[model samples]
Target: MNIYSWNVNGIRAIQKKGFVEWVLKEDPDILCVQETKAQIEQLEEKLTQIDGYKSYFFSAEKKGYSGVAVYTKIEPLNIRNMDIKEFDFEGRYMELEYKDFNLINCYFPNSQSEGKRLDYKLRFNTAIMKRCNELVDLGKNIILCGDLNVAHREIDLTNPKKNEKNPGYLPEERDWMTKFLECGYIDTFRYLQPEETKYSWWSYRFKSREKNIGWRIDYHIVNESFVNNIEDAVILNDVMGSDHCPVVLRVSVE
Candidate 1:
């Protein structure tokens, strides 16, 4: 199965920039989207009615904010949103249960400059870890993907030293990620290409993409036991509609 994930920034904006055409061409078995920034009612039929796929979306009550979606060729047994009210209010999480595993597409909250939203983001981080543990306790393997909003290690972003105190690269956030992985989840891209220095998201300012000064904050993470099922993990920098590019996880799972 080829499962893909991308942070579209704004679904509406991308639609006008060849998003539909790109989806048609890639045709992944499942596509997980983050930062949809649109409510269900606002979505054009072209997006929801994409051929051979069933689409599910979770939008923020505030509208045009944080949101997520899943377009799958294989129907899920059920779809779910994180029940935690504080986080759910922002439409940050979704779980799609299939026979083989649970797929989670999440758009983590940005901490912002000077750690403005740091407290809230940290709380959400804890909640996600708990959720992952709950599923594991129930004997479910998970394929978690999306923009996590943190660079786990210095190698994950350009000039890590210069970005040390930045929100995405903050000590607290990086420590949380380390703790998350240590709890039995594996980062697919890092597991497959340990030495690769590719990035997924770039800044719109300072011509970041042109200079390749980007961060590997987006990911396809899975339970350690499911790691063997992955055939390849890739950062599809060539495919773009937003500041972030799509990530591909080729795995031998239903």
Candidate 2:
């Protein structure tokens, strides 16, 4: 099935910028959205018209803040909002359990402009990884997607040297990502296109998108067991609704 993920920045803003049309064109069987920044009530009228998909949204308690949503063609057996103690308050994770696997959409904490939130981000990462391991131990396949907000390697960002001290490229952040991958998860896109310099997120400043100076912070990571079934992993670099573009993965399942 074709599964896609995008951090829309703000669902309302993108919906005005033809996000609906873009979704129709892509025709993914499932779409996971991060940074929605709006509650279901606010998007009721606009998204209700989208056909052939069942939608589930988890909004932060704080208005206009972090949130996530999932739209799927196949009806999920169960949809759950992760209660990761401190992290769940921001509505960062939503999981859909199908007959064969669990699909998780997450909007990881951004360290913020001053790096004051780095500690919290790290803690969240640890907790989430633990949660993922718990699921994998159950022998169920896992598809984890969203704006992980960290550049895994120097190659994942435009200028690694200059960005060493940057929030997303900081050594601590990158190390956490390494730990995640080492825990038997496959970074799907990198697995398929290792030499490609493509990126999913761009800075809104300095004409980053125009120059293609960006970071590959978003991802679709699956457990190692499903690696052989991965058909294609792609970045929709041409599409624009937010500073981030969409990342997609197609995998085969019996």
Query: Each candidate's lDDT (Cα)?
Result: 0.94, 0.90
Task: Give lDDT: candidate 1, residue 81.
Answer: 88
Q: Give the TM-score (vs. native) of candidate 1.
A: 0.98
lDDT of 1 by residue, 1-254 (tens): 99999999999999999988888988999999999999999989998889888999999989899999999999999889889999999999999999999999999999999999999999999999999999998999999999999999988999899998898999999999999999999999999888889999999999999999999999999999888899999999988689999999999964
Candidate 1 Cα errors over 4 Å, as ranges: none
Worst 10 residues of 1 by lDDT: 232-241
Q: What is the lDDT of residue 67 in candidate 2?
A: 95
* lDDT of candidate model 2 versus the reference: 0.90
RMSD of each: 0.8, 1.1
